[model samples]
Target: MSIFHLMLSSVVIFFVLYAPQPLLAQFAQLYATSPANTGLLMSVTMLPLAIAPICYGLFLANYSKLKLLKVAMMLLALCSVLITLQQRFELFLLLRFIEGLILPAALTAMTSYIGQTWQGQCLRRNMTWYVGSTILGGFLGRALAANFATWWNWESFYIFNAALLILISLRIKLPPLENITTPKACSPKDYLRPLKQPSLLRLYCAVFCMFFCFSALLNYLPFILSNEYNLKDPKLIGWVYGGYLVGALLSMCAPYLTKLHNNNWVILTAVFGVYCVSISAMQWQNLGAFIVLFTLFCACMFIIHASAAPLANEISSAHASITNGAYVSFYYSGGALGSFLPGFIYQTAGIEMFLLSLLLICILGAYFTWLNYRIGSETQLGR
Candidate 1:
């Protein structure tokens, strides 16, 4: 039941966080904005998320993880309701910004709960489940938002999200565990301390690059579908992300893949190899092929996530909260930049250049993964 609650909470966190993705096109038309400007809808939410560790770390350090989860959920639900009622685009952005502010409380609490609750096989099982739940939530958020926007109105979807979050807050509970994450007190420096390790630095950098590539592709995909393929229907556009479901499946396979390779870096390197190939293949100008490649793309990304997340926490167990917080901050920092900055490339240079840019970023991620592998090997030889 505790795991189920955590999984459910994980789903809702990502669901609210990503719900706006597929609606970018609709929002553009309604707001009279450019793709880049409208992309800020995704960026604004992610920007706060990027700095969440530094921003929210101390506050979360002192709070009960379960209690913080409930409060954050209700606050997020309130923002969702306000976003539903607001008419002005500015106000909507503000509401979304507020949502970003509140979101990390729930996210850190959940991840920290899992980190502090279990160890060994139990830890791997629960973390993979949590990752799978998040992938499911990401898929549902976009698919449902796009479909709902088509059926009713764009803003009304938030109302539904608000209701769901309220229910989760009320029903979900976790057994009180001894909180190991709190320092005598927390400072921004405490969170920053985890980055001092060379391997953790490489892992965080690799994660940043991976998510940057992933976020840029997904954020701009609607425009690609609507413009390049001449597919205007939001329903069909939503279905394009049907490929995203494979990520959940692949994430669940992380423990298996890890055992098979017997090394996280090796698996990550291979996944990024596939990730790079998928991005390169997207340049082929065929929608069916692109969808196939996108599924592979999503798979590679999530497996990397499932592998890296636990690895980061394990590496910095003395400060699991700080380490996990930093991991998430780097993850979304990539996402925040990826959600917005690449639009200029897409808008100015064309899709080929845009993809070329992402390909380069993935290559950089693969390089960092290789570095991690080399460092791990050296450490093993020393041992």
Candidate 2:
């Protein structure tokens, strides 16, 4: 039941969060903005999302998980309602930023809730489902909004999601849960001490590049496909992102793959290689082949995500929460920058250039993956 509740939390958070992405074309037309400006709408959510974990540690550390979850859920619904009602484009963007601030708490609460509810292997499997479900939610959020926009309007996402969140909040239950709070006496140096470890910092760098590539590709793919492939319909564009479901399913294979492979980072680097190959193939302009490669790319990215996340969280047993939080902060920072810069490059240069940029990001990610593994192995042998 806790897992089910966490999945529900994931579905609604992601569903509302990405509602604006598929509508970027419409937004540009409505607001008379450039591609870069419209992309800002998507990137804005990630900005505060990146910053909020540090703030959470500094100020909101004492808040209970259930209490924060409730506040976040309620405010999320409000943000959705406001977005739905907002006719002014700038105001809408601001509201999306507010959603960014609210989101991390709710998401953090969901994770902490799961940790409280389950233990050992049970905890691990449930966490995997948590990841899969969030990925599914991201897919559905965009897919459903785009699909419904044809019948209703762009605002339909907010109207529908606000209602869903309200419904979920009304019924969801949890036992008393506490945040993995830093003790008030925990200083900045103390919190950051784990980061001085070479292997952990490598994981941080690797995950940042991993998410940067993933976010850049996902955020910009709609624009490229719509403009280049002559598939401009919102509904059609939304369906293209269904490739994310392939990633979600592949993420489930993480546990098995790590079991067979001696080093998770080794598997990660190999997967990154496959991911780069697939993204590079998008240059072929063959729709059938493009979709297949894109699906493979998604698979490899999520597989890396699933493997690296647990490794980052477990790397510092004494400060697991801080380690996890730092990784996510890095992840969202990558996402914020990736979402913005690729769109700017795509706007200024060309789609070819954007793909070239993503290829570079992917290759760098693979390097960092191997670097982390190599350093960790040497440390073990040296010991």
Candidate 3:
């Protein structure tokens, strides 16, 4: 695929994945619901996000990646439009759920396309753009919805996304992918084989922990800021989210960082170590202190996600597609769990307890990273 096509594809992917978050608070207000219940809007989407990848991994084993992506994008467009029309909570949630199902196919196709066409620095550059697009989409989607409420309505966000999707569909030219036919029959038991590897398992656990922590913050940060900080300006919310720009820059730096040292070390030090410090700093209510800490936290998260994603792909080279699908599935499943657990914990205990819980989870993720490093080193030595 051309560079333009690749960039366009990434934009579409990012918008589809993250465009729902800014609207969550709005949805809650409209429905007269709690933060916990508003979380269902996201939780519902994650269910399909987890399930669709596995099924598509199997079903699309013999299909063309470009064709699959086109279909998936079309489905996503339709769903975005449909979501705008729904007035009832049940209908809204159901449409989001179905939207999730369409995501895995598009995501899988996009990843496979990039993997086949680019490698080394080229791949990393494209992936960075992909990450940036996600950050941009998320920030813009929410900012636009909140800031422009007077201009149109909340549905304008969905409409804008739908229009962007249509433009991408018309312009991007995707390359054909390899078709896996007459493949060796791998049973469900076989699919579980990657989990048997200690390195892979550790990576999976780290992903679960990282996403769980990140999701909790994303789901609750608005409420935290509004309630605790007493900030009512939607534009301020958008600017605060602009902290992700720092993360986007960090993700773009991953390839260079990996060249200097092992990615596992990067994950251990940046993700676990710095992230913990940043989260701990959140206790200080000063605006400057909060911004600095939040920026550091996001930067570390970008480092971890960038490093670990490629490592997940490397863990099972033979079944790269299936392995990637599985990794994303786990990643989002953790997100779903993260979305719900924080609210439950906060309701029962308090925000202090909830944040403390996240701190502990980060420690566990750090431990897993250390173990992964040792195992990888020993295996290399033996070889």
Candidate 4:
């Protein structure tokens, strides 16, 4: 039951986090903004996500996870309701920024709560389910948001999301914080300390590029469909994100893939190479071709994410939470920038040029993976 609630928490947080993505095209038109500028709807939320994990790890080490989770969810629900009433675009962005600040606390609390409550194989199993729930949340959030917009109005989805969040906040349960042992509080320097490790730094850089490309493609995809393909209906636009489910399944397969290759970095490099190929194939003019390739694109990206996260912990077990926190920072930092910056290329140059930019970034990611592999091999030989 606790695990069920934990997974529910995972799903709702992610649902709230990404619910705005499919509506970017609609938001751009409604707010009277350029496609490039409209990207801020995502970037404003992501920027806070990129920075907040470190603070949570450093300062909230001993805080009550259940209390934090409940408060964050309730506040996020309020933000969702406020977004429904917001008329000014700037205030809308401000509300998104506030959502960003609140999200990390919910995420940090849920993950920490898991560590506190479980151990060994039980812990691994729960975490895997947690990851799956987040993927489900991401997919359902986009799919439902667009459909809800088409069925009624854009604000309808937020009203629906707010209701779910409030229910989850009031119902989900967790062990009391006093029952869990408190970790030693970390200092600010601890946050920067992971940057000094070469292998960890290399992994961080690779994931940044990986997510940068992923966010760029997903964030701007609706514009391409509506503007280029002349597919304006939000219901059909939402269906395109059906490819997201492919990612959820592939995430579960990542551990098996690691077993098939002895050098994990080799697998990482190859997976990224495949990602480059899939996105390159997306340059085809047909929407069907784009959707098929997008599915492959999603599969490749999640495999990289599923593999990279555990590797970060393996590389630095002593400071596991901080390492993971820094990983989130770099990953979403790429997302923050990728959510907006690629809009200019897609807007001014075209989709071909936009994809070309992401291809170059993936190539760089592959290089970083190779660097990590080489350094790890050298360290092992020295040992």
Give the Cα lDDT of each candidate.
0.80, 0.75, 0.70, 0.78
What are the per-residue Cα lDDT tens digits for candidate 3 across 127-163?
6665566566666655566555547887886787887
For candidate 3, which ten residues in a row score worst on lDDT?
Answer: 374-383
Q: Is candidate 1 or candidate 2 better by lDDT?
A: 1
lDDT tens string, model 2, 1-383? 46787688789889977888778888899889887788778778878878776555333334566676777888999999888778887998899888888888777666655544555456557777888888988888877888889888878778889898888886666456654545654566666665678877777787888788888888678677888888888667766777778767977987677666666677778888888898788889887787788788888878877766666555543244455566668888888778778888899989888889989988888888778767756432111
Cα error, candidate 3, residue 320 (Å): 2.1
Overall local distance difference test of candidate 4: 0.78
TM-score of 4: 0.83
Candidate with top lDDT is: 1
Q: Show the colliding residue pairs in model 4.
A: none
* Inter-residue clash pairs, candidate 2: none
Model 4 lDDT-worst window of ten? 374-383
Global Cα RMSD, each model: 3.0, 3.4, 3.2, 3.7
Off by over 4 Å in 4: 22-39, 84-91, 112-125, 150-156, 178-186, 223-237, 283-288, 377-383
Clashes of each: 0, 0, 0, 0
TM-score-better candidate, 1 vs 3: 1
lDDT (tens digit, per residue) of candidate 1 on 1-383: 38898888788778898898778878888888887787678778877888876455555555677888888999999998888778888998898888888888778878877877777667777888888898888878877887888899977788888888999899966557645545563556664665698877888899999999998998789889887888899678767777788666866788787666666678778888998999999999998888888888998898889877877766663355666777788998898789778999999999999999999999999998888778756421111
Top-down TM-score ranking? 1, 3, 2, 4
Which RMSD does model 3 reach against the true structure? Answer: 3.2
